[model samples]
Target: MSRLLDMKEFGEAAPFLRKSDLEILAAQTVAFDDKPTKNIVGAWILITDPLCAGKKRAWIPDEKDAYIEVEIREIDGDKVIVETKDGKTYSGLFCVTVNPYKWLPVYTAPVVAAYKGKRRSEAPPHIYSIADNAYNDMLRNRENQSMLITGESGAGKTVNTKRVIQYFAIVAALGEASSKKGGPATKTGGTLEDQIIEANPAMEAFGNAKTLRNDNSSRFPLKQNQSERRRGKRLLPSRQCHSYTREALMIIQWNIRAFNTVKNWPWMKLFFKIKPLLRSAATEKELAALKEEFLKLKEALEKSEAKRKELEEKQVSLIQEKNDLSLQLQAAATEKTCRLYEDQMNESKAKVEELQRQLSDTNTQRARAQAESAELGRKLEERESLVSQLQRTKNSLSQNIEELKKQLDEETKAAMMAEELKKEQDTSAHLERMKKNMEQTIKDLQMRLDEAEQIALKGGKKQIQKLESRVRDLENELESEQKKSNEFQKGVRKYERRIKELTYQTEEDRKNMARLQELIDKLQAKVKTYKRQAEEAEEQANTNLTKYKKIQHELDDAEERADIAESQVNKLRTRTRDPGSKASPKACS
Candidate 1:
């Protein structure tokens, strides 16, 4: 309660809370205290009641007098559920409730803390978990990351912002300590974590102002700029501490201008006085560090200058030694050495003349060899042509053999078909004879029936009955013969089908034979042309072979002359090398 009052007072001095608003709040508190006594209501009753708990209720607004229904669906460790009259719903670990007496803001701080550093899906929905996720992302990526916290006035942006900054400071300090691992501790006089934590109070004091909606609303916005170095992974604030003072100055200037319209603000005067001291201190520290670096560079420069002088002396000695050696070489050059060189030159000229003669003979040999190779190449081409022609002949012969085999197969197939036709014709002839014999038997029975009828008229009724019985017997025999005749007809149809199939097969065979005959004729023509080409190629090969042999002989003779010239050149070289030898140039000649 005391902390709350202090915050209220601070808001007033910081010009964030208006005097009229404070007065109105005070009057409302007093009126509430003086009102008639009513039964004390516990929040637990609303949570546990069957009708109200986990159910929606409509209530009239104090300011607008309009009724709105709000439902409280659930309350769990992870989240609370609330729904409005329009079917809109919200779920989170924190919730705000309005009562007849006051507005209550409920927080599930412990539940949110339990899920810190967990993924958004793993953790329950909460703002703290979002901050934790952003921090983890920054650590994992080693790159710039930003989180934007935006809301209307009085939405607790400032409070959440402070919490996030505090979290980073604590985490960074702990991480730095763990990384040291018993190494020497780093000085943290003005580390980024310390500066950020220190800047929070100053930022609120100058930038916050009063609004109708929020008592302590930020008039000037806060921006978090995150960046990373191109060559290193250091965060922006770590390398940009100098820029913080400039931002602070701007905030101070803004506060001064805002309060200038009003009179007598002691905090504003205090801020004006401290701004210069902060800037000067930062400037002095930077100057001192620069001076120390400048002195170190100067000492390094002097050391390099001395080393350069020592190297210059060594270079002078090397130049002088080179000059002395040149003079010694000049003194060693004498008349005898000159005369010896002249003699060597004359000997080299003689050797060169002998080498030229040898080269001329080698050229002649090379020309003959080339001519011989050309003649051999021509013979090879002729031989290849003959070989190709023979290969064509072999292919033609193979084709002819294939055609002959096909013809033989066709002949064999035709002979088999002819034997089958002869058997079928014999069966057909026997069937025709049986048919004629049946017809003749039928005619004889008809004649015998006519005679029986005449006899019946001459003799008694007994004879007529006997004659009718015989006629019935004869009719049965005729039916049996007709059945046999039908069977023969079916056999004749089967034979006719077989003959039709054989005729179609014979036609196909004839076409195949015709095609084979044409192929055989074409192959025979090719064979004849190939034989002619082979004979011509063989004759050309023989002619080229004789010419090659003649060129080979000439090449061998020219090579022998080249070898003789080479031996003479070798003797001249040995004489020049041995100065003590009795052999002189004139003597060799």
Candidate 2:
């Protein structure tokens, strides 16, 4: 009774709540973080044992069945990556699906039916699961529920939405509702369900084509639907209002109390007591008493009218005060909005300027890197072409040396046989020494060629110097062999011409080998220098690419901030109306 009276005494006023008295502090909430007031609208609630935080990535501990259990964990994002690799598209409340781009058995009738009564937690994460939860919540709370299906273009938002709609169609169906409403004589001449289902294809083809920038977007019907159903839904709110029901109820209660008090009056009791005695004696005293009562009732009625008029006037005064307060509130709200938008716009402008400066610096650096890379690239290509030509020349020199060496062996063998026929032992000994020196020089030349092919600059240079000294010794030996041959010219006369020709050919081959060795050393050195330049160029290019990407990202963020500022400006413009321009409400007759 005391609580009732307290409530009645405090009637018709909005309730008051302080921040400290708000119900935001639950057992799970450890503390409120109000330090970050600039970005978010409200303070953040700090909680303990968060499922995922403070980690780059982690795989779920349960490796065997990550798909079966999508609950968020202490691990950050590794489990999500692993799940994607294993074809698990959903993680907790988020349905991160890929476009299968084809029909699947997952959304069949049986599957839709399976999710009808099950709670979201009872099933694996899916679009149907979300829809089922929404439906269940709407039924349980007697309120509407909305699910936003939003993503970038080609993200299957439409496909997922269709699945949700199909799920609802199956789950919220009244048994044979179509047949009961649109029987055989209906316009479609089919079950009401069929006509309803047919309307959806037309709607999906055009109405739900994302014509509106809002949730559950639909196109306005013009040459479309042309149905009474659409017209009936165009009702607007009524402008008429009535007297406060609370005040009316209070007036009724007062009148009832007054009537009860009058019923218990002493005059009423005396009249009942004297009714039988005065029934036959019609007297002027009774008439005078009745007249006095009528006058008293008339005065009472006049008083009630005055009291009612006073209450109406009081109500009007309260309404006037309320209107003034509303106007003040609107002004304050408008000012706050303007201030907030101005701050945001200023911050956004500063950020954009900073980003532009950074981008200009990045462009300068990129231009320098590109210029250097282009110059280096041109030089490298030119050197590479020279290296290719040198390589081919070196190969031909090597082959020619091999053929000349074979000729030397044959000519030496023939000269030895001719000397043996004449019994020239001294010449034979000298010829054997020349053959040994020639073989040693040939081995050195082969080593140099091998080093050249490998582009070993230091090793090939050393080998080439050794070959030069060896070639000089071989030339002196060849001269001695020529003199020895002259000593045995008579005994070995038949092979003299062949020996001279072989000597001349050997010297020419020696000169060619020396030139090839020099070319190999220079090629090896150029290759080393070119390789270094190429590496530097590649590293610079990578650095430039990374810088460009970073600058682009910052530029994108700046653009988004600027867009937000502009949108806020637009919102303020829409809401900042002239309070005095509003007309007074029209009174009903």
Candidate 3:
């Protein structure tokens, strides 16, 4: 089975718009449908045939988006004239064109029948041939197939790529599952959405992998222009069937006007011009049929209008009835609320009276409590006075006890001082006896201390301290000298390393300079040779130009002389023909 769809129709024509002349004539005539709003103020319109009432309508722009999508409405519009040329619409994407293009006559339902199930060799050379070859090869070989298209900018590469995609989608479709090894395929069936979702990861992976150098391989949008146009339900509002009838008389007048205008449309002219006789008799038949249909539509429209008017009147009456019922309901509610409030007020009044009685009882109880509290306060005052008297007696007793303690402490201290004085008298007598004994021993000790060894021992401590200070000063000086020597060693090593680095750098610089000088000498020699050659070439060119000019001038003179001789010959011939004429010598010369 084969189904052929026109790329022309898919890209350019609406579902019902392939024959634009008649269909658009119907469009212009049916109605000037309006659904006005004040959302910064805009409206929409609907137009359809008998059963297709709300199903077909035109989008009147309501906002910047004009209702739904972004202004991407402008993409193919700008390329229509150029792209439409040569029956190739979408290939214009890859090429610069002067006119915007949409669809063409190729890849239509009729043409598709020729290629369906046909081998590559069976069909003429075409993009379909290439795609069909790939498909056949894959099925025949049981392996993958590829169609590689490579081209420079403006070479229709992208356009051909898109065609391949559409060809695969329509031809060897993967919508059904094929069993493998007698088991169910992993994926049996998927929706378009699911397939798209599955493809997203691949697109993301490939797009991200592409580099700046390969911009053409990145960011594939896979957009369907057909989807954008087809998925709309006539651009009508969600709640369709507004049920308002357009004037039948107005519609008839509009159709009469439409008949004239449709003839002028490019497609209409093409249709008539291309058709044999326009099949003229068919035109008459269609016109007659259209007139009959219009009459019937007009009559039906009138009947519907009358019925709609009647319905509108009934709707108005119903709305009024609803308002009246609502008013009655509101009045009943208000009455119920008033009755409830009155009952609450009566209950509140009873509560207030009972509360007043309770308040009086509480007042009597408060008065009884006040009398009992006063009696207790008088008892408390008496008890406080008795407590103050007891406190004063305790204070006097504590003062008497403190005085007795002070007197006892003073008497004990006086007794301790007398005992201490007696012990001191005994110690003084013993110390006086010991002093006489020490005086005898001192004379003996003085004789021993006068010896030289004892004097030397006493002086040795100062002499030893002076020597130690000298040793410490010499050690510090020695340490300072050692550190200076180490520092000099480090400086010497660093200086040697720096000298070696400088020497190496100087050698490298000398080598580089030598190389540079050699390069300069060669460049100078080449310059001298080129200069000599240039001078020689210039001399040769000048000589050749002079020779060419001299030759051209000589040739110009030769041509002039030859023209004069030829004219003289022609004159002699003319004279010979007119033998009767006398020939003057000047004319002969």
Candidate 4:
């Protein structure tokens, strides 16, 4: 049996171990009955041999090593010979072996295959293979498995446990994916594989620590329970399962010193008694969230307070402006300047009205003068026509006078010839009388023609002189009326300009009044808002005061309760010390 064990180890390490090294190992005696000799010899040959060491594989001493040496000298089934570097020979189960990195892969490969699908018996004997096979059997039987991994502080227990969990998670996830035709499905909206993998890191963060033998060593024991639930035909992990591993470890640590003294205490009763206190204490996460919320509320309150202060400042400025405007209004009402402007406006209006009346009068006068001038013009035209007619009559009279004078001269000649002829013929008395009558009539007509000429010339000259005087008088009157009309137009323009100035000034005053009224209304509205804000601030302050008082009251009540509990604990200790208290307990019951 010892030879077969040696051969098996040799066969397993043959790929990396040299033939000379195997011959040296096989030449040694194999001990199977002595468990310590068998294990030590096997560990030394497989792990500490220099021929089996690769570039990354070397021997590491145990923590208790006092010196380095090739201690193995001989081997046998019943006894083994070992020699230290100082030539000290010893044979016993008390032996130290070095850990070799080269053996880990050789050990893990078969376990990995066993996890895949290979039979556990076909794999080499290893703790990992055994655990893997057991986990597989449990999964096949649809049963639960509980694994408790414990060792000395630095035995790599935590690391081995993490490896086991990783193997199980990977193999199980693959199996689940293969069972479903589609693929691995995370119906819970989270990757189940990742969550299972992450549990190691989360647990290590709180539970693992560094030690001399191991960097990541679990300081406390862990109890992991994995179970499958049968719902009709489907076998799945139980969703309601919970692990209080960390809490249990914490409780153990808390009562570690007093565990022996209070070993018989009723833990269930004590836990119930302190459950309310545990609930009252704020958790780290809850306290952190509350601190963050408090800070945010404080910042918001500060901003609101700052806004209120700004509004108050604005209200003060508005009040000052309103007061100033009121003072100005009062001063304006009392001062003489407004009355003076009004008087000036009234005077300008009166002047404009008077100028209008004057302008109207000038218009009427101008119209009358225009009418008189037209009448005079008509009379002048009539006088001119009369003068022309008199001139024409005078011209015709002159022509008639000339023709009559010629005829008279011819008649006088004829009369002289007739008188001579009558002397010759001894003229009759009736002829002499007719000649004398004709000469007298002719002399009377000539005198009447000369008087008519003098009368016509004198009358025409007097009419022309009267018409010339009337035309000059009318022209002077027209000139004076036009001057008055021009002066009235100038006055009307001056009054219109003054009126426009007054209207503009009144319009400006009206706009100013409207603006002031609007400003006052806005100030009043701001004052109301400020007042409302102040009231709200006061109410909030009062509410905070009430809350502070309530918290203070609760704090006092909690302190009183703590004092009472401490006194009762002291009294109980005293009663426990006194044996007479036992009888009192029986009497009370």
lDDT of 1 by residue, 75-151 (tens): 54333344444432433224221222332221223333333445655533445555566666656765444455556
Candidate 3, residues 358-461: lDDT per residue as tens digits? 54554555455445445444544554454455445445544544554454445445544644564465456546644654574465345434542465676867
Winner by lDDT between candidate 4 and candidate 1: 1
Candidate 2, residues 349-457: lDDT per residue as tens digits? 8887887888788788878888888888788888888888888888887887887788788769866885675566675665676577668657756766776667575
- Which is superior by TM-score, 1 or 2? 2
* CA lDDT, candidate 2, residue 2: 18
Winning model by lDDT = 2
In model 3, the worst 10-residue window by lDDT is 77-86
**Backbone collisions counted per model:** 2, 1, 10, 1
Evaluate candidate 4 by giving its C-alpha RMSD to the native, one decimal.
Answer: 48.2
TM agreement with the true structure for every prediction: 0.21, 0.29, 0.21, 0.21
- What is the lDDT, from 0 to 100, of the residue 378 in candidate 1? 63
Candidate 3's C-alpha runs over 4 A off are 1-304, 311-338, 361-398, 414-589
Q: Which residue pairs does candidate 1 place in steric collision? A: 16-209, 16-210
Residue 41, model 1: Cα distance from true site in angstroms: 90
Instruction: Give candidate 4 regions above 4 Å deviation.
Output: 1-456, 521-525, 552-589
